[model samples]
Target: MFDKIYDVIVVGAGHAGGEAAAAAANMGSSTLLITMNLQNIGQMSCNPAMGGIAKGQIVREIDALGGYSGIISDETAIQFKMLNKSKGPAMWSPRVQSDRMRFSEEWRLKLERTPNLDFYQEMVGGIVVEDGKIVGVKTSLGLTARGKTVVLTNGTFLNGLIHIGDKQFGGGRAGERASTGITKELTDLGFETGRMKTGTPPRVDGRSLDFSKMEVQPGDVDPEKFSYSSSTKPLTKQRDCHLSYTSPQVHEMLKEGFDRSPMFNGSIKSIGPRYCPSIEDKINRFADKDRHQLFVEPEGWNTVEYYINGFSTSLPEDIQFRALREVAGFEQVKFFRPGYAIEYDYFPPTQLKHTLETKLVSGLFFAGQINGTTGYEEAASQGLMAGINAALLVQEKDPFILKRNEAYIGVLVDDLITKGTEEPYRMFTSRAEYRTLLRQDNADFRLTPKGYDLGLASEERLREMEIKQKKSDAFVGFFTNTSVPPEVLNPILESKDSALVTQSDKMIRPFSRPNITMDDMRKIETVEAFIRENELDTEVLQQAEIQIKYAGYIEKEKNNAEKLNRLEGIKIPENFDYTRLKSLSYEATEKLSKIRPVTVSQASRISGVSPNDISVLLVYMGR
Candidate 1:
């Protein structure tokens, strides 16, 4: 088995590794996925949900690019909801409550069924890099497998140390052993590594919780899915999540355990996610607050285990039990397991190129928590890109790169590579300068064709995207040309508290009005007739409506993006001496020299590179 060399070897089968392996295999690479345990592939180690806020946009982009996350997420979804619907279209993201066990099982099955992909259950001890290019990986059992390219997506398992109060154990997650040797080997090979901490909340017995005291959070009335393919559908039934809160008394009880907490006591020096901190951290930081919200989510449809969403802590077991029981719904809570903070080694992402391939180690890639990113969607997107680029390199094809304006995935990669996160990087809509152009509704329109061109996306996927785009464009054109009589439109406008038209007006005018929705527009006789005549689906109608409604904003963002793309085209030569440019700031010269940004726009985004420095470089380049 070690004799024949594979094209791409992915070590780790978490979200990132799963997507990476699937994408590489699907793209025609003879891929091998090595993991410590086969059954735990695609484990929702932290949360049983996928997508939220800006994260949902990422999942859609993955689907558009023909990645399996969306397909698997949609198929195993227990509930689905489109988050931030009350906000603008750019803010809208699809989130789902997944059956945790099924989510993992689905991913395993999908990867197993994928041609050109093979799985082996073992701990990859270290990678084999000869003269800075990946050759293969060495397993803990002293076996070796040869590969041309290797992607390390080892998520939170590299020398993982789990903490529960003052007690620490060698584990990546509950019931999972920590992976060893890779970190030490990589560091010895000149890789910079730092420790990062992330914690998950306790899983309580659902049968012991009091539902009457909690607020029920239900799925959307019309839930959508993550996958663009027709292979999966939105869930018809949903297991609702319940909202509870921690009171002052709960905080007081938790405070007693703070002295023993690894976070406050200095037992753990690594940084955790700032946005999603542990409950103890929350209470300590927000000391004046009387209460903090908590969401109790079920682990699976067939199980009684419920995950405490916002109550993550590494507090002692006795303290965790005492404090949790003070909450409304968890008055008689029975623990399935206690929450723990795990400190694991991660490589700062700036060491990698835009393709997620390491600059230091050619043909070697990094993804997931190993890259210091937090969240399944972010990890999955990175994995997909790394896999795509690895396969492309093997095929001797051009590397696939997404610009900041092209996608949220583009923004994510650019941020990681350009900025180099000291803390865990999570995607948010505010992080994207061109969020208006990266809406969840049009990921397929933005990227499926590109995916198809690379042979990652299927012909059927591209055809479906093309048809949707064509129909939606025609529908928008129809609205632009069609008009409605005052008798047919004025009443509907009046009901929405929008200004009523005195005379006949273009249907697009009223439809574009604030508070006037696609549903409201559907009431118009002419609009409904045109829709029925065109045989448009909900997705098409929504797309057309958003285009019509935010046309000016969309055009403005496009113009801004075009400006950025111009700078993106201005390349900086490799080994370019920044010190030679006397006009450049000392800080800028040092950073630019170190990062060696591929493009001027990328250099312009570096932390210390001022506008004057960019001008200096542009002048030096004779731009």
Candidate 2:
């Protein structure tokens, strides 16, 4: 069955593998996606939701780069909400409550529709490396599939061990089989491996939940979808989620099972996510808190299954049932399945380059859980880059790397390679230095051209971005150039209790005021006429408004980013010995020698590397 030497081979068809395969194949590579089970392609392994906070920016980046996660998420979403609307544009994020089943279905359909991609059901045990380059993968069946490059996205499946309190079993997920052989193979090949654990909350029957007892958490009044493409649309209607809380009584019930908790006991030694901790861990750590919030989210539009968000646990089944039933909405909660903690193998990402390619093995790449990152969005971004780079490598083209200022994806990659994570690394908006410049709204403006040039993003995608850019630019230009008389601006300002202008002013000045919005400006006859005549939509108008309002802050961030780019451009010799620099601190020398950052900008970001160390490099290089 494996005759031809393909361009790319992607193992483990979770979020990362799916995107990786699609990217490579879409870029005209003969890409093969192999998984343990083909039926579970694009499965939502943890939560039935996509994008939140900083994560929403990443999904848009993926979409902007022609990846399918945003499109699939939008199509399958049962609910949508743009988070942080009260905040600035930089903090604004788009998230979706997905129909879990449909999300997976849509992903499979998209992959099937894609060109130059093939699927096979197999657990890849190890890669066949030749001379320091990945040649192919060897499956569990002892069969070899040849490819120029191989991407390992084995998300939480490698050596997986699940613990439901005292009971433990070998399984990747609840029902799925655990994968073996790959970790051993990689370890023998000199790669370091670590154990990390993560837990999921129990799924309950919606019929069993008492929504009247809990606070209603309804979807947004005007929901926005994930995809920037025309392929999907926003949900016209949305399902409501409920908010419940754990009490002192619930905590006591949960404490009964802590003795048997894999996390609490010696059963599990792996580090779990710091942010998304287990229920037992939460209570154990934050003992002073009277209650913890739990979101009762629907799994899908049609299913009876509802996810118990913020209630993740690995306690005994009886204890889980007893404690959950004590919660506000879960008065008579009947579990579909008890929550369990799963420990799995992960390879530290310092071994990977910015492109997600392994530095030791030329054509080998690692993405998803294999890289010790946590979220679905994070995994997908890595896969997209890895698949792209794999294809580019086969085509003998230059590698693609998004700069720190340009994308959150760039920040994610740079952080992982620069400072290797000890626990499951989750992305936060605070991690990004230039969050103001990397707004979700302008992802297409930043990445579509680059995606198009790589032959990954479609021409139609580029045209859409171009058209949006043109319209918004014109609208902003109008705002900058057009002046409105006091009569037109004063009336609107007075209504909002803002200072009334005594004289005529450029419309942009009034529009930039916090009290003014596009709607307020539209009241001006000329502004309304311009919008109508130009046939501008909500998106373009909003885009123009942001540019006008945040121009100063945006300009400041851009300037700062440019200054950082000077260091980014200063190349570090690949194998330069930091030990030779007598002025460098011991910590900086050790870190720089181990991480081997390609540029001074990257070196400066290292945890131990200080300002003085950066100056040493500059002086040594005669900069």
- lDDT tens digits by residue: candidate 1, 1-623: 66589999999999899989988999999999999999999999988999999999999999999998899889888888898888999999899999999999999998889999988999999988898888999999989999989999999999999999999999888999999999988999889999999999999899999999999998988888999998888778888999999999999999999999999999999999999999999998888899999999988889999999999899998999999999997888899999989999999988899999998999999998999999999999999999999999999999999999889999999998888999988999999989999999999999998989877789999998988999999999988998889988888888888887888877888888878888898887777888898899999999999999999999999999999999999999988998899889899988888778999999999999999999988887889
List the RMSD of every prediction in angstroms: 1.0, 1.0
Clash counts for the predictions, in order: 0, 0
Per-candidate Cα lDDT values, in order, are 0.92, 0.92
Model 1, CA-based lDDT = 0.92
TM-scores of the candidates are 0.99, 0.99
Error of 1 at 456 (Å): 1.8
**Candidate 1's TM-score:** 0.99
Q: Where is model 2 poorest over a 10-residue stretch in terms of lDDT?
A: 225-234
Q: Positional deviation of 119 in candidate 1, in angstroms? A: 1.1
